[model samples]
Target: GAGVSQSPSNKVTEKGKDVELRCDPISGHTALYWYRQSLGQGLEFLIYFQGNSAPDKSGLPSDRFSAERTGGSVSTLTIQRTQQEDSAVYLCASSHGGTDYGYTFGSGTRLTVV
Candidate 1:
């Protein structure tokens, strides 16, 4: 892809249901990130993966939130037993490697837990 791509642009699920959001980063990019925005709130970093190093999952709100990157290209964010409070736009971004460069972000997947 020329830029970051995310799947299922929008999703609506009942509370307690699980949902999966996907992201495909630009070719040759070495860094990927997942973020969430609730309504008017600012973006919240959920996780980050850099090259072959261990992923930083410090920002995940709870054990129900998890993510994985396969082959360093495609990534997935899974939320188990969704809660209404989890409703937000999930964003994915990729960068060449560092904060020195701006990131290319996906349009985001809007997840709504009813």
Candidate 2:
């Protein structure tokens, strides 16, 4: 894909269920990020992957949240034991690896935990 892509635009799951969100970054992009945004709330950084460096997991809210980038391209975010508080739009973004480069964001996956 020429731009960042995410799958299953919307998902509704029961509490305690697990969900996996996928992200396909633009070709050649070296930076990928995952963020969560609750209704009427601001974006919260979840994780970040850059080139061959170790992934930055500092932003993850809990051990149940995890993510991985494969071949420096596609990435997946997994949420275990979904909770009502975890309901939010998960956004994925890719960039060319610098502050000067603008990011291309996916439409985001809306997760609703009930």
TM-score of each: 0.96, 0.96
Please state the error at residue 64 of candidate 1 in Å. 0.2
Model 1 backbone overlap count: 0
Best by lDDT: 1
Residues 41-65 of candidate 2 have per-residue lDDT tens digits of: 9999999999999999999999999
In order, candidate lDDTs are: 0.95, 0.94
- In candidate 1, stretches whose alpha carbon ends up further than 4 angstroms from where it belongs are 98-100
Task: State the lDDT at 87 in candidate 1.
Answer: 98
Clashes of each: 0, 0
Name the lDDT of candidate 1: 0.95
Q: Candidate 1 clashing pairs? A: none
After superposing candidate 2 on the true structure, give the runs of residues whose Cα lies further than 4 Å from its correct spot.
none
